[model samples]
Target: MDRAQRLAYNQPTWLDTVAAWLLALLWILPLAYAVWTAFHPTEYSTRFTLLAPLTLDNFSRAWEAAPFARYFLNTALLVAMILAVQLVLATLAAYAFARYEFRGKNVAFALVLVQLMIMPDILLVENYKTMSQLGLVDTLVAIGLPYFASAFAIFLLRQTFLGIPKELDEAARVEGATAMQTLWRVYVPLARPVYTAFALVSVSFHWNNFLWPLIVTNSVKARPLTVGLQVFSSVDQGVDWSIITAATLMTSAPLLIGFLLFQRQFVQSFMRAGIK
Candidate 1:
């Protein structure tokens, strides 16, 4: 009601704007450091100079020093293998959970909900044990096997499927469409946004995943980028900051590029596919 109270209510403060910029700066500080160190020579890594001679030599050294090509290939194969199987399995399970009527359905879905709450790290021991028993240790299959059944994917797709009009399902069935045909033609296409969102989450998580891959892998043959980075930056090698930073950037470049390119689609997909 007073002038001071009205001004405070009607206008934003400079302090809030300053705080937002400060937080943004803090968030990007590490990435800024990485870029500076990776692009400059070792001598200039710590010493920030406007005239620091930038060079590609660090990246060249990084690539030649380790089996990065093999690590990249393994990581690509692992993520693709995991995503392919997850989409197939998640779609089917989500369709059934959304549309089918069966005994123990609610209980089964409840179990999945519980699984979503439990951290995958807790299952590391059992998963490793199972993989060992199956003789899949130290393989791409081992790294991706446990994550193939994604509770989060199933839940997201199921929610999307539930929101679809049931009349469309009836119309499809009234035609010559079988149940499988109905699912492929109707549900899958409708839930594409949710699929996109889940795929992004899954890929990013597994791309950065470290401990499980580290434990299961013994050599570069099966090691992903995260594990490869750890081995590349081993303490045994006298720390070369430029080369180490270059290697780190190289490993994470795919994800950074992907997020940059698809950022709009990624945000829209999440918004559109969010629970109604």
Candidate 2:
């Protein structure tokens, strides 16, 4: 190559590199601080001395201070229940939108799409009233009831279903497959990546959900880890950074570990779903 071309090629992209590193640092600073505070003594929480003493007492105390085991169970059940209902409802709705031609089909889809513009938090009052009337207040079922039908999930799946070739559906039908069978064998299998991506998004959102859960649940019986952490941190004894950070880490550990372990699959699923 010419000298000028070589010089141009060898020039460093310092700006982009610095910008990326800066953003990454900003993103991880809270997590890094949490780890630092959670592991060290309370006196060192605001200090960054490298030789600070580390202890596991905070974790022990935090665990003993709350019903974390029950909280964990409640969060797990909530995420699973919401995900199952969302998948089933979204799949059925998406299938209808994708394959069926009916009266008011476009209008119905328009209504579904309209939900995407509306924030779920905006309907909290109505949702609370509905739950109250149903006598499901202060229960896990109440927390998950409003989210059983996810517009975003339905929209994503419907778009994916639309991208699927009609030939496969016809082939399945020619082989005597019913509509449900065709959907199961042809569409569902092909849409696995989309499902995975949606599952990840749904689980992460609901796992970290706080406001709705706080409003709907009045006791530890239905409170998720997030609410439990808040309650544990705001104690009458006053906030101790060490104990609070330790509890924060404990509550967030599952999601962090899960993301670290399945990050590759998560990215790949999103890529495939995006392509479809």
Candidate 3:
């Protein structure tokens, strides 16, 4: 290695190793506790013993206590709709900004960048007012509408598109391919890693989104799992740690299982995307 590289990337010291282990323990402690509580009887929740009996009754009780099936359906639909719309819009917008020259293009891109700086939570009241005016409140569409246009996705895709070679675009045009066809068959295929990376972020964010969905939706038909879980854990239902933890696990299991299954692909997508 070069002198600069050797100096800048020294091996971890003993203290660094200790700190890393401690942080990992801190992160896993809660999940471990939740797993233990969810599988064991309520009485054994606080007491950790090797002889503690395991049961699926907690999961059953949690399921019966709420309309989780509807919540799951609603959550699934909401996530899919948002992801689909965001991908379409982001792709078109990114292509235009990256490949075409137009009046005030820099100013328009600056506005999009401004959106990246503004936090979505800051617009909650305004968003609610708009949704209310459109009579979209209390519907799945209302929850997904505000997120249909994603600035981050546009920026990411645009950067990826810009990094692609112009020779590819010229070659496709030489073959008599139109603009849309070139985008579909050339740029889109080349940017698959970036799309995969962005899709992961969008899906995870929308899946766990709570405050906005909770504010916009009331009925079970529109409520996502996070909102449903909150209502399930409310005092009106009485506290049962085992059941609550089980419900938590149930709601989080899809994300956890998805990660476990796609961990390699996820890492590879991000790495390739960053390189592009």
Candidate 4:
């Protein structure tokens, strides 16, 4: 009960620990390399030396070469606009799906779920054509168009709403609360965790999205951070690895920082949503 039990309980779980470390290393290694390159001198970036000269030269050079400030502003605007619309639409749709019983409701919801299975990126050609017809091509709105109606968001929120007791809704109604009022005052507050989780996931995905933005935005004025990184990478003058890595860091740092800052909220949201 003493020595043997202590040994059994305290013994290192070598296999599990090793596997976890390997998984962490798989992710951390690339980010570490990127940071190293970002800080390393251009001459030392690709060099095998353990102690190559580190400096701010790459970051400064990358910043000077591109209008990164503009890119950040545009990306922020685009992400905000998309999230705003998605939140409204997803909430309403989720609420309706969770509470209402109408003809073809199941069919319509099924179709919406189908969009989740079919990658939104695959529909780019049709979406681009629609954007062209709407005269929204090459705009920030165009870059956000394809993601405005998120099936996954709708589904997640609907599930969250369903997990709430019907009696809560009935109680709200008994107090003469309208459906909209009940949704705002009751459901939304209760589902805050799911909303936070979804927002984190959505922001991360849209922040890193490159292909749709690349296709829709033709100018730096509308290009998001991802497009900005690509444009810098594709410059024909020459390939500068150090500068490229620096640019990548600048492009991704905001999302990384946001994740770190909101990690507790993000993790709690996902956990609560999962339990629901």
Task: List TM-score per model, in order.
Answer: 0.92, 0.94, 0.94, 0.92
Local error of candidate 1 at residue 108 (angstroms):
0.4
In order of listing, the candidates' clash counts read 0, 0, 0, 0
Among all candidates shown, the one with the greatest TM-score: 3
Residue 31 accuracy (lDDT) in model 1: 90
| TM-score between candidate 2 and the true structure | 0.94
- Regions of model 3 farther than 4 Å from truth: 1-12
lDDT of 1 by residue, 20-41 (tens): 8999999899999999999999
Clashing residue pairs found in predicted model 2:
none
Output the better candidate (2/4) by lDDT: 2
The CA lDDT at 17 in model 1 is 75
lDDT of 4 by residue, 24-92 (tens): 999999998889888888777767577777699888988888899999999999889999999999999
Sort by TM-score, top down from the best: 3, 2, 1, 4
Q: Which RMSD values do the candidates have, in order? A: 3.1, 3.3, 2.2, 3.4
